[model samples]
Target: MHGSRSGRHRSDPGVAAAAGDSGLKPKGPSTLQALTDLVRLVGRSNAPQLRLRLVGAVLLTLAGKALGVLAPLVLGAAVNSLASGQGTAAAVGWGFGGFAVGWALVRLLSSTAPQLADVVFAPVRSAAQRRAATETFAHALSLSLDFHQTKRSGSLSRTMERGARSVDFLLRILAFNLVPTGVELVLAAGVLGARYDWRFGAVAVVVVAVYTASTFALSNWRLEHRRTMNTADTEAAGVSVDALLNYETVKSFGAEARSAAVYDRALGDYTRAALKANSSLALLNMIQAGIMNLGLGVMAVMAGFEAAAGRMGPGDVMAAVLIMISLYAPLNILGFAYREVRQSFIDMEEMLKVTRQTPQVADAPGAVALAKDTARRGGSIAFEDVGFRHDARANGLEGVSFNAAPGTTTALVGPSGAGKSTIVKLALRLLDPQGGRVLIDGHDVRDVTQASLRTAVALVPQDVALFNDTIRANIGFARPDADEAAIWAAAEAAELTAFIRDLPEGLDTRVGERGLKLSGGERQRVGIARALLADPCILILDEATSALDSRTEAAIQKTLRKVRAGRTTLVVAHRLSTIADADQILVLKAGRIVERGAHHELVAHVGGEYAALWRKQTRGARART
Candidate 1:
């Protein structure tokens, strides 16, 4: 059986209150607020350089649009010259030269400006994305254990990844596509109004107005479909990841079929959502195409009539057609840009929500680091009337008080759910008591910086989760800067060196995910080795040897006896025989200590809770023998 870490800690009420109010669901920021935040975030990225580039980009955009509008006029002049029977070779050459130059310049500026803007803006965009991802990741790590337990790891990862990409996409669309398109629209309308009859400008403005209205209305309608597709996609990924992470359990229970069914269901939902999203997109495209083509046809016919009536030359008709064609390009992209921008906003807002959560446990203002001198004295732990409740109903520690004097070994023994594991977590300050205080080395744990406090204590949990790396790396995690000699010494003390040496790779042997490649006993030894390497004043063995066989347990117990010589040890154990030599033993029932004494002293009480437990275990052992 694999050793498992006990989830016996109480949830923080502050975290609970926050979760109740915010509900952990993605609550997107309002559209206006999201846009404002995006702008602010972009502005924060190397402001001096970004502002310079932004100015240049804007100027280039205006110049490009100006040339774009002027190109049609030049083409019109060339056509008019040819139609007026001025067909001389020089005249035609000059006319066509001006038209070609104007058109070429328009294309050059339109394409070149955006490329230059991208070059200047790349660093700013990258910086903003990095800041957002880093802050969000750190915040997620800082949140309460309860929050992490309730959230899916895969979903959180996707949120950060997608959110960062969305920032880049949003910036590109706003700067290169949407803003420039608006400028071009205004310039085209102005040109038509100044150089032609009012009807021409009116037609251009009306077409744009209608196109904008239709795009907005349809894009808003597609928002729900896109949101649904995103949700389904995230869910599918989460389900697949969760199923794979528990690969052993799935295989053992012959749950491969069931897991596949669950995954298939998730994917099925995603497929349906994707289909709907694509279908709606197709409809939007068709509608936009119809609107654009109809506007172009109407404009062309009106220009032809104006030319026939002598109010405009044939060159004016060609210019009108070219301008309308140019406007169609931007209008074609408008729907897509709007939809993607909206989705990006939603992604960014989701990431912001994670960053907004308040960490349940934080270093208090003016919190100080643990004194090195004090920690060197072998940390003493005191639980001064500590109390906590998991919830309104669940059993939790109640007025639990104990002391583990420096260099002493104290053991907690109890039935499952008797708050034994909770005491261990509290001692390590993994969870804070709602009432009273926990002190280490005479300083309240809450009053010290967590980093410094944790440095003084180390835990060898029953389930030793190892990263998918070499055994050497896992052991070195406790004291990352420890020399190879120290790490080997610690591994030897944990009785793991001989086994590691027998392996083909020695210390370099890879421990698969969570050390699943190792036997349960081997994994526990790795945990012990890591803790020994840490060399902290206080050592917490939370059923650390529970997975080992009797022979391995005895050997590890001998190693632990030596390791505990100058450290305060707190043990939460189910094996009565293992902890018989403890200096003090606590017998808990419900949420409180019902009996406490040395093993011999407790056994002498006959009918006492500890004595009864010892007798029951002794009888069971004799029967097994």
Candidate 2:
């Protein structure tokens, strides 16, 4: 039967070929597309009040710029009044007073506008950041188990953090800095053209054009270095987190030096990339300074020539120089802003990669909720010719069919790779069968909502993972609203009451990361207690007693038998002794059920697979004795 199963249930070449595609590679959209998407994401917060605030911010920006531009003109007029021989002392005093007041007021408005804009837009920026993070996180959780398995947790977490921060930075730069700077540039050019010579305006335009072109060219060249640095940084962080998470493994193998070497190598790569990026940055800054100073020199020399030629006054030169100086502030920021903006786009694109992955499993539109009351007795489960394949090389179930009647215990005994755990996951709807249907209480499992279905079933796996929290909290996780009394009752059923009472903090004791603070048997017992607390209609024990000692196993077996009286139980066991008395025993080999019957009936069949397995175990028991 096993040989026939393999031949008849070969996986399709197409499905097997695509099984390893995890969608982690950085295949980001075009720059234009990314910018458009980011803009839309920021503006998605459709608050009418936010729109009003945005308008107010824009108005303040324009008013501040106008005031700033008018200040230099007033200063120039005061300088002209001082130079004029026909002007009286009173006129000079009035000119000086007006200049001082204008300068102070312009500085006040220029500084005040951005601060007020920040206040008005604070809520909008925060909302956008929160929305982006929440949606990305929720989408990540909804993805299939396969994707999570292939991804590094630390790297994934970093992507989310960096991505959200990038969005906030981009919004602030575009709204308050980039747009306002452009407006200021235009106003400065207009003033030079209308109030001064057209040559002055042309010089201003040339300076800006040259500065912008040089910054962009250099920034684009530095982009590859930044990307390399980010990659190395992410890799180093992932390695450190992975090593720390498996600290015990490192200690046991005496591989601390090896881990350190790996980490150092990653850091070395990062160091090289960072040095290159910093060097490029210095080069960009030097070139930018040269351009700005050169422009100022040319403008000043021209102003002096015009004054000597009687075409302009000394005050006009002061005004031209002042306007250029004011323009310097925004221009300086423009270089930094452009570089950071490009890097921000890269960060956002990495996050978008995660969000773009289509979930392998999702609830169908208009899916109905599971009827909890229908399984009052027990939920009857059936696999109708179910099939699945992890990959072409890995063994998976094929043409496997079975039925567990309500209020009965069924045991599946199989070798290590016989698809026992796969069957369990399929029953839970964690992985949908590619070729067949799984049913609970005569209804298709996929037809109902996953949340409702999962609530009705509880599983106790071989390896129990616990949060870094208190024992009471972990147990109560199965049913968050469960009363303390109910929690104690479940603990008692799992034979964990005495253990808890002996602890210093009792139920309040903290379980270290993944419950490493507890022994193997203790963790398994806690898992059993949590499952029992749920009071699920169907209980699945996937090698649940594998870690227990002989004595603890016996005790747990007794508890299991007592619990099996009302609820339907499905046991996947490697220890044949644990399931000897199960109502029905299915012997699986490769991916097929080669033998099926009561334990005694299968063991009595001459030369059968079950009999051979029973003899092997019996001989081993005698040898141990």
The ten-residue window of minimal lDDT in model 2 covers 10-19
Residues 1-625 of candidate 1: C-alpha lDDT, one tens digit per residue: 0001111111100000001112134455688999898988887765447777777766776676667777777778768776776668887788777776776776677667667767776777788887788878998988876678678786788778777777887888787778888888888888888898777788898988898899899888876665665566666666788889999999999999999999889778767866676677778878888888889999899998888999888888999889878877767778767766766787788788898887667788999998763444578899999898776448888888989898999999999989987787777777888988999989998899989888889999989899999999999999899999998999999899899999999999999988999999999999999999988899999999999988989999998998888899999998899999999999999889999989999999988999888899999999999
Off by over 4 Å in 1: 1-27, 46-48, 373-375
Worst 10 residues of 1 by lDDT: 11-20
Where model 2 places Cα greater than 4 Å from the true spot, the runs are 1-28, 46-48
What is candidate 1's TM-score against the reference? 0.91
C-alpha lDDT of all candidate models, in order = 0.80, 0.81
lDDT of residue 595 for candidate 2: 83
Q: Which TM-score value belongs to model 2? A: 0.92
Distance (Å) between predicted and true CA of 161, model 1?
Answer: 1.9
**Tens-place lDDT digits, model 2, residues 123-145:** 77887778778778988998987
* C-alpha TM-score for every candidate: 0.91, 0.92
